[model samples]
Target: METMTTSHSLRSTSINPANLIELELLSQIVTQKQSANDIRGSIPYLAKMAQIIDNQRLETTVAASSPQQQQLQQQQHTLRLLQADAHRQLGQAYMKIGQYIQAEASLTITIQRLESLLKDDNAATSHSIIVNQLIEGYDLLKECFELLGKPHMVQGMENRKRKYTTPAPAPTQATASKDKSSP
Candidate 1:
């Protein structure tokens, strides 16, 4: 009975299909079966998964989807978070093969997704985590631009890092007094 219960729990916690695909894609890259010239084979599949997850979320928001087909709320959130991470990994794969342009594009998409998430109301509790991801994305992206010999492109990423990670300065005493008097 104990062994049967353990097996049932393991089966219930099986990996997601989309995540399984993503893991296989990453393995291909790691094993050198996928290269810059042929990343097309993997990217489109991952992109489709991301799109499906996104559309599923939208569907749930506007109307009831069949509960049998619907992803759980926690699953949806986890998948959305992984979407950004997968792109970042893809960008690294591109970088490894010296495909700077593709690397830049993939990392930029990752940064954009991370930034968008930061704007969500629920992101408050995870602000530091998101900011760290953004910083890492920007750093990798800057490396891509540098390798591509576009020093100018890196500057923009640097600025974004500063903007995202730096806190605004506190008001000085003079400014605080002026605001107090005006009100």
Candidate 2:
């Protein structure tokens, strides 16, 4: 696993990177650790990555309506998603480590963050990615509720999960044909 050698180097170096490489490396390490069932080992890395993402400042010098500003906004949105993902992974790790309360907190934050992102009209991020993250968050939250012995919350999470996992109603043949004919 990459964690064997890279983990040591990651720990030795300060992890404040202006680029995404460190974030990607941290994510890889977290995934590797989780795959090896080393949930505890991944927690600190996940926490660090989340912190780094949350603290990153976008320093765009252009006007708000400029293309550079738009790109920076997109980058900021992506960073927000990445931060939410880090929290989701941390929640999953906490759940595996039998820390239900911490898991619940992290998962709740992940869901809230994604939900807000879904409301952003200017978001360049795809709805499917946000929806998928929400589904995962709900699933993890369901487990947290189960672990915490909250049956009602578990059912609520299940319903919320279904809301995202359920496909949208397909267009009727008549409607499709009418639209095609009109065009």
Candidate 3:
């Protein structure tokens, strides 16, 4: 399975010119280290790289305006999603290193940001894409809590997961009968 996007492809097709250089460099580092043998050893470096990308994205987002503002906002949103993915990866790495506290912190950030982005009115991205991301985020977070021996936290994650994954309730017989009568 493909695990990472190459910097070249990201640069050529998706990234805006304003974020080109920084994002390319960050993506290169992330892609190269993704399959490294010493994944736990790479957590700090990966987390720092993700932080740098997020800081740049924040600065660009704050400065957005005028005719390019809408386009820039969309690009920055995409960058934020990438940043969240980096954080999730870093969290998993932290988990491998037995750093439950750090893992929980990183995973919490990923889940929160992803949930926020999924709430955006202008987010025209695929619903399944965002939902899948949330599922991954929550799954990792639940693992982190379990490893930390935090049953309450684990329960919370489970509840959130069910909320997202469970189908809506089927209409009650009374409601169905009322509907037929109205028609």
**Steric clashes per prediction:** 0, 0, 0
Q: Model 3, residue 53: displacement in angstroms?
A: 1.8
lDDT of 2 by residue, 1-183 (tens): 444665544331122454468788888998999889898999998888878777766665634667667676677677678778878878888888998998999889899888888888354458877888788788889988988999999999998888778888999999999999994
Tens digits of per-residue lDDT for model 3 on 1-183?
Answer: 966756645343244455656656756766666667666556656777677657653334455467567776666678778878878888888888889898898899899878888787354555568788899999999999988899999999999999889999999999999999994
Q: The CA-based lDDT of model 3 is what?
A: 0.77
Scored by TM-score, the top model is 3
Q: Please report the TM-score between candidate 2 and the true structure.
A: 0.70
**Where does model 3 exceed 4 Å of error?**
1-36, 58-69, 121-125, 176-183
- Candidate order (TM-score): 3, 2, 1
Off by over 4 Å in 1: 1-77, 178-183
- Winner of 1 and 2 under lDDT: 2
RMSD in order of candidates = 7.4, 9.1, 8.8
Model 2 clashing residue pairs (backbone): none
Q: Give the TM-score of candidate 1.
A: 0.63
Write out the backbone clash pairs for model 1: none
